[model samples]
Target: MSAASRAGSLPANLQGLWADGLNPPWSADYHININIQMNYWPAEVTALSELHDPFFRYIERLLPHAERTAKKAYGCRGAVAHYTTNPWGHTALDGRIVYGLWPDGLAWSALHFWERFDYTRNLGFLRDRAFPILKACAAFTLDYLVKHPRTGKLVSGPSNSPENTYIAPSGERGWIVMGAAMSQSMAFAILSRCEQAAALLGVEPELRARCREAIANLQRLEIGSDGRLKEWPEEFPEAEPGHRHISHLFGLHPGYEIDVDETPALAAAARKALDHRLAHGGGHTGWSAAWITLFWARLGEGERAWQFFEKLLRDSTESNLFDTHPSGGGPIFQIDGNFGGTAALAEMLLQSHAGRLRFLPALPKAWPSGRVRNLRARGGAGVDIEWKDGQAVSATLRPETTGTHRLIAPQGQRIARIEANGKSVAWKDEGVRLARGVVYRIAFQPAG
Candidate 1:
């Protein structure tokens, strides 16, 4: 979330449609898939890496499915993808456009791409495709939010948490509520990204106050005594003891509302709940596994982080291609899996740990010699990185408006590296660099 972080942009070579190499994708295996709700990124990354290499072409064949899944202003409801013939927009769900409402996963893609832009600043890619995706998805939310006539709370019903199903305290037979915690997290992130994009684009605006107001009033589904994130605001819900989706964790990971720094209690609450889910055999599906992996990474649990990652790759996908059962197990794959794994793998290498970019937190001890081409992390002053020989050999850092970076490396090491006036300079272990936004090189040459 610093200018320097955003300034570097993604290396163009890595920016193009990656078909193979690190993003290994394979064939459709699932017998039934109602992927109309949203596309999956975790599956897509794994598949895309496979497709990135020159030898890969199978992932491309899956594109027709993704294209069919794309929707214009509205997020596709169930069965929306298969029936629509147009390039975008859902025409029907179960053969009727009964509800073309804004959905959460659609909101995530908008935020995800915007965050990616900081690393992959392919403006043309963002402008032509990513921006529209963000704009329309966000516009739908802006348009869709309707205030209740009496209580005046913004309501988004027909919404679902997708993890635990609740029981009404009154015993009226409960169901998923609209704008639940999961949905709010998704919506909040979408709005925040919209605001960020607007600031970046200049030229125009939105009612910022109202956006913030929504953030303020957005309800967080309460936590039970068991410490697990609840399904809804009502009584103890009849939960899925082994389900894969931990939809509510959005506030904890990608959206980043709860963290040890700002919201310790909520962060603890989230972790408590997430841990319970994992302990209770709440399996990690492709996308869910990716999120769980990310959460562990964010929390600085390197070994557990690696374990969750393994489950995501191995447990799901046949031959490491599709997600079918737990830990991304589905015969037919979801595109989100690809993006999720890429993110998890990348995060293990480096992280913007609570707005301070730290390198290599949760990498598996054995894996050696790998590189992440152009990943971005947010720090107010410097964009720092070091990669080579499966370790960060040297940190090439740039400062935004001349600032400092508290550089943390593998094994919990820390150093202060500075940058001034956009120029790379030699710096001491403690600190060195210009004050007005410069680039600096911090070397960690291996013993000869």
Candidate 2:
């Protein structure tokens, strides 16, 4: 997926020569709910930054169709995509409201631009290309939101939690509801990215202010009565206790809002939700298992993360390391699991989602010696690390731009010395201010 995406020649789903029969399932279209998005999870982080171009190009091609979808279907401004789209940028619905009514698709797509900006810090790209798409999506989010009658909070309505259903308090099963946490979280992310873009570009003050105001009115994620993060705004019983899609945890992974340090309660609720899902039969599919691995890494649980990683490799992978989904009879191929697992492994080695470049946050004991190069991080940094006995022996960080970066060294490791291009330097607990194109090396030993 990374190589093909980098070449800009990969299909939305890479069936290659393996595609069977005339009527392949789903017509080989990009399923935006999670599949297409999952395929690119490793691109930027693994330093295949150029791979994002094809996706952005696809988004650009789809914008006009998406705009029509938004205006015609919801009477709202901006763009919208259904569950699936072909290479030609078709944006029509799939006829099933359960997965079809998800307007969050474009909002979620906008996040790729945000992720690219996070990795590159290329203000020109953010201003000229990424911000326009994000701002348009934010406009859609603003226009698409309806006031919840009970709480008056801005909410999205008549949307399912992306292929999942719930039972209401009135004993009726429904796929449509107001404020599926996935949509809310995606909107929040879009708006947050727009605000940040505006700040970086030093333009669009009105848009930034509007985003701030709308953010205030957006629905808040709440822990359900079951001690888990609610999939929908209300405490509805899950139609499938072990549903494969962990949509409610959107804010926890891929999205930036929920953090263990900042929102411990929500973090705990996310963990509980995962436990609930796993206690049933969730994470059975390859992509879902990959997502679970990512969640565990985000929670800083290396052992649990490694366990799931192993599970994905064992049960959900083909001989070529491509991911496979479980059919009633046997395994079926899916590209998302492969890409998502790639991202998950990178996360286990190094994480930057919490606004800090954390080294070896979830390095598993199984991988005692390894080296990774050219993993991108937020704040315009590139990282390369080598570890032995699960301990970071040395790591090099290159700053593409000059800034003070909050650096989190490997847990339980003490820095024996730090140097910038061989010159000894003082490392501050707050952060290290770096110059453009300069490399900082840290020599560390295990903590006693």
- Tell me the spans in candidate 2 whose CA falls farther than 4 Å from its real position: 6-11, 14-18, 446-448
| TM-score for each of the candidates | 0.66, 0.96
The residue pairs found clashing in candidate 2 are none
Candidate 1 local Cα displacement, residue 303, angstroms: 1.5
Residue-by-residue lDDT tens digits, candidate 1, 188-254: 7776666666656662365455566676665555676777666554435554645566667767666
Supply the global lDDT for candidate 1.
0.51
Tell me each candidate's RMSD, in Å, in order: 9.0, 1.7
Q: Please, what are the lDDT tens digits per residue for candidate 2 over residues 1-448?
A: 5545645564447342255677665666688888889988888898888877888888877889888888988888888887788877778666688788887777788789889988888888898889988988988888888898889999876677999988877887789988999888887899888998999889989999999998999997889887899898877778899999999999999987788878999999999999999999999989999999999999989999999999999988888887787777677776788889999999999898766778888898899999999898888888999999888999898989888777777779877877987799786777778888988898888778
Sequence-dependent TM-score of model 1: 0.66
Worst 10 residues of 2 by lDDT: 10-19
